[model samples]
Target: MKKVPFIAVEGPIGVGKSSLAREIANYYQYRLLNEIVEENPFLGNFYKDIDGWSFQTEMFFLCNRYKQLEDIEKYHLNKNEPVVADYHIFKNQIFAERTLQSKQYEKYKQIYYILTANMPEPNLIIYLKAGLNTLLERISLRGRDIEKNIDPAYLLQLTKDYEQFMGKFINDHPNVPVLTFECDHIDFIKNKADLEAIFSKIDDQLFINN
Candidate 1:
């Protein structure tokens, strides 16, 4: 049997990161890993009062993500099974840093480092990029009640932070291949050709073009 690769998809909210991750996992018969987003007890309140509930929300996410990664490591990585995850574990730091206060962020960083110390990293990363307006439209189309009132300013800044985080990630992990796509013009969710194109890119970046 061929060695299965671990793939991860990342993007700002409503960029169809999860949707595309699902497509890839299905197409390739890889294990699909979805983030535990709405499960965080403090998430709803964090959206209402970011400053007040940020710590609780971040901590909850940290613990959950850590546990998820541990499970993935033991169950999939150890077996060499292919895996595709909607969100990489490292993204925990990006949100925590952006949400938590300085002192809180410092403490969060310490915890993040410890949890991530022995975690497995993805063999390939797919970053879906879309314009702010495009993301807003998609967000409305999805119609999630908790996300309806997301602050535009906060979302905008979060998008920027994601881009910056990817930049630094690329610099830090040069061996890991990252394939970025400008998905504003393509609808991978409904367009088979578009999805195939992304798959081709993944192949090209991580295999063919490597």
Candidate 2:
């Protein structure tokens, strides 16, 4: 198969985006670009006290993702390697809108829109969907120390927001193919059959279109 130029997998917290991106990259020999949440100094603090550090954490992520996208664009165009990124730049805004106030969202939106205006969109976007209870279970199993106190209600709210936002985004960008998978009943990372099923869906979406 001639490689698709770019692909991205995105979902809410504990949805295994990085896992899927890495697995696909390894499988297809694409360059993997994963988000660096572990490297973000403000992440722990933000998780502990979102009101105080939400803007700081979001701004840091926004800038960091922009840089990654810029680097990916230049590198991929120059060297011609298919690219698989775990998250999209817009995902940060999905969180920011929920965490930030109206004024704060307005301010951030101005900058985000300007920066991403001409950015390259992925050839295919694979979106994972899971129920709130499933999301909480995954979060607990992952056991990130900072995430121990994460409110299930907050996650539920974010899940709703993600669904709405992704729904609208996909509607607006009709040319961008989105493969939405409900993850409430399956664990793609741990279940071999589940992983194969997801991969098969991806293969068909990416290859059959050609």
Task: Tell me model 1's lDDT, rounded to 2 decimals.
Answer: 0.86
Candidate 2 lDDT by residue in tens digits, 53-103: 899999999999988888888878447778999998889889999999889
lDDT of 1 by residue, 26-137 (tens): 8888899999988888888888999999999988988888898889889988897778999988888878888889999999889889888978888888998888898999
Q: What is the lDDT of residue 139 in candidate 2?
A: 82
lDDT of 2: 0.86
Clashing pairs in 2: none
Residue-level lDDT for 73 in candidate 1: 81
lDDT of model 1 at position 182: 89
Error of 2 at 175 (Å): 0.6
**Candidate with maximal TM-score:** 1
RMSD (Cα, Å) for all candidates, in order, is 1.8, 1.9
Minimum summed lDDT over a 10-residue window in model 1 is located at 201-210
